[model samples]
Target chain A: MSVLDSRRGGGNGNNDDLASLEAGLDALETHLDTRASRWRKLLSATWPPVLAIVGLLGVWELIYRSGVKPTYALPSPADVGLVLRDQLSDGTLLEAMGTSLTRGGLGFLAALAIGTPLGLLIARVRPIRRGIGPLVSGLQSLPSIAWVPAAIIFFGIGDAAIYAVVLLGATPSIANGMVSGIDQIPPLYQRVGKVLGARGLSAARHVLLPAALPGYVGGLRQGWAFSWRSLMAAELIVHSPELGQGLGQLLDFGRSNNDMSLVFAGILGILVVGIAVELCVFAPLERRVLRRRGLLVARS
Target chain B: MTVLEEQRVTRSTGAVSLRGLTKRFGDGPNVLEDVSLDVAEGEFVCLLGASGCGKSTLLNLVAGLDRPSAGSVHVPGGRAALMFQEPALLPWLTATQNVELALRLRGVGKSERRVRSNELLELVRLSGAGGKRVHELSGGMRQRVAMARALAQDSHVLLMDEPFAALDAITRDVLHEELVRIRESQQLTVLFVTHNVREAVRLGDRVVLLSSRPGRVAKEYPVGIAHPRRIESPEVARLSVEITDDLRTEIRRHGAH
Candidate 1:
């Protein structure tokens, strides 16, 4: 056919060049700023959040300097900064941060371990879904603080109690996140999977799980928040010397001693760590998933 | 309610035979009733109907995605590969990986999978775009990749349910040409379903129109026009107009008591 076309001198030789050129043009138009001067995009995306944070700190400093409240009641930004500096220098704050982060990390890991399989079972098993679907949703609305007393009763007021509270708080959100994620997947994906002979476990692995990722990511973020909050709440309520000083313990100690700056420092510590985890761990994961799927619109 | 039984047939067998195929969903009226058709090896058959017609249900029955209430759907060359209107590529997978996923399910091995996946991508004219994610592809490209994924199943029969119905006219024309070229080169038996008259006449060797409300074969036109047929050509237009008239009458009858 190629020889005949070439002999006739009319068919595909010129059309091939034209087709390639058309493909090139299509590629150019559909290109979505990948691997081409990406750093510029990164910098542009980063600046606004940085500036807003700096502005927030500036306003806090100005209000303190205006002498709006008693110095004891409202510590100056400098005083909090000094407290931060002192804690770093003495290594006590570092130790507390280490302790609290360890607890939060362990608790979140435990929740992930337990919650993922539970969520899968809840999502896939019809009888269990019918029985416990509402129960899981109900558990999500119950504040993690409410679990503190029950945890204290079940596990006698130590690290075990804290761990128990964190698990109770985080597991439901993770499980429910996955449930909703599986629910939201378009039926088209599963049909495609089946036609391609992906059934049962293969269908769940290839189609359902990956399709449900965006919602699962949302659940993970919520799960982390609940775990962190529950851990802190448990720490504040049960202050045994054997458990070491977490930020929550420091805040509790500050309340007892009337050290407002210390309390302020602890609150700041909590906020910073939460933001760091979100930025460092989960935000990048969510962004990658969304960007790969073109669900995330690139920031201008 | 016959299970899809494996029949020992010689290789190079190229026909799908449906004998008294009927389907009904739970106590509702029959979705497809007593539909019988035979498409030869390397034949292009288009199943045309209105929206509510059970054209899709018939395709699903042949593809083994749906069970018929009665009768038989025998694709002599084995299970027909199916393509939907949507690309339905897994977003986590790149275009090549989407095709590769199909191959992998067929138990193709690692090194061979990569080589075969690249070959399939090239067949769809998406050789360079294999690295791109599904979302990054244009609508036309995604559908082409879907065609590639469907083809990757390596089945003798291909069942497509309005695969190109979603594309704009220009892109649709280009893909129509691509599909015909591939069908000829591969000698595949195709059972394509569409509501579009021009599309049916343009691609099919035999255009089979199904009536709505328990879809059954209403009419059949054997297209004698030579290949490398253009969708905009006069031959396609003349046939499309005649078929469209019949289709309109069929649809209007559905509204009557």
Candidate 2:
């Protein structure tokens, strides 16, 4: 007997019915991508942070007016703003920022290169994971600042020492992130990869790595933070004429000269740079990854 | 003839053949035991069993994801394509890219991969959804993309592990029709596993009921009902009732033991 006995007599009509039915079902069930206007979204996101900054400045001004500490010890917000403006006009602030940013960028890249492979090995190879898994976790928890003295002693207070400290600080977090990312991948994905004939390195590259990406991006953000922190700590400790003037060095310079405004200005610059990198670089990258995977729900 | 010789003869003839397959995990009871089955070229076979019957284990062994503890599984058709209960499409990739990944792994060239993936998506009636990400698609659409990906494997045998068990009833019925059309058009061999008796009756040319807990082949029913059989049809309902009764009896046997 023919399998398509019923279908053959009225196949075209049936197919059209099936097609239309499927379309109706899809239309009824599928989610429409409704979005608020871009300007409204931007305004909503920006206002709260802007208000918080204003409130913080107001409190700082109140404390200054109250004379809670000497002007030399605790400079007013306006005093710090003037110091920042002067440093900006004189080009020293930009130069310090440029120097610190270059170091941070390079250190973060180096950490990424080392950490990615280390994480894959730890995640995939059981014996290696068993051997070094706890050690990587321990390194992440240990204060990165504590490594500056050892790094200086080893590399002798140069750019090499600063990079060493940054690598020490960031590499563990990146590797740990990779481990957790790989661990979190559903076993079904691996099975799907296998069924698709993806084996060994191909499986790792195509399925495992991409599947672990959200976690890996999270790790990268943390790694960048650690790199910046370690670089600042190193600059503060290992100051020399040849080491160049970074934000940390600028802060150290203000301490030596007893310029409280410059000190506050240096603190402000560091805070701004950290926040800027997070807002400008990592936040967008993270949102893009999460949004692509539909992990990020629309605010509305 | 000896059992080995008989097994070899059967294995050579069928598109997929399992001879005395058994599996157990880490000193636990055998999940499957001495279960042998075969699917001829272009045949549609539904493996029906209760939970813990090792139906999934059987599919995994055929797909080469797992090894049989004792016996052998022979698929003359190389590397059967297996679909899970979930769509299992890569969330990072768009629908077309997910299918293309399968083609790329199969060694299809970059230029050809796009054309072939689009054609496959079209075959699944998802031509317009190639650019949509996994999460952007509805549940039914995602499953269709998965079906497209499986088709891209270019394998003769398709193993489905209850691919529609999670769908709403209406959607499931629609996919059942879609599956029938796709099977006929492709001339593909299918080995589908499910606990739903009516589903097995609706889709299969042959329904093989398996006993649970050291899963053994309990019975096989050749469904002689003509195609385009409704799930509610008398023929389909009658067979389903018989099969459900048999399944319940098998489960009761375990309780009695």
Worst 10 residues of 1 chain A by lDDT: A1-10
lDDT (Cα, tens digit) per residue for candidate 2, span A10-43: 3778888988899898888878878888899999
Clashing pairs in 1: B14-B41
lDDT of 1 at A233: 92
Model 1: what TM-score? 0.92
Best by lDDT: 2
The structural similarity of chain B in model 2 to the true chain B, as TM-score, is 0.94
- Candidate 1, residues B55-118, lDDT tens digits: the string is 8898899999988999998987787999888878889899999999999898999998998888
Which regions of candidate 2 deviate over 4 angstroms?
A: A1-10, B1-13
TM-score of each: 0.92, 0.95
Query: On residues B1-257, what C-alpha lDDT tens digit does candidate 2 reach at each position?
Result: 22422333455459999999999999999999999898887778999999999999999999998999999999887989999999999999999999999999999999999888988888778888899999989889989999999999999899999999999999999999889888866777899999999999999888999999989999999887777778999999999999999999999998895
Docking class of 2: acceptable
How many clashing residue pairs are found in candidate 2?
Answer: 0
Residue A221's lDDT in candidate 2: 96
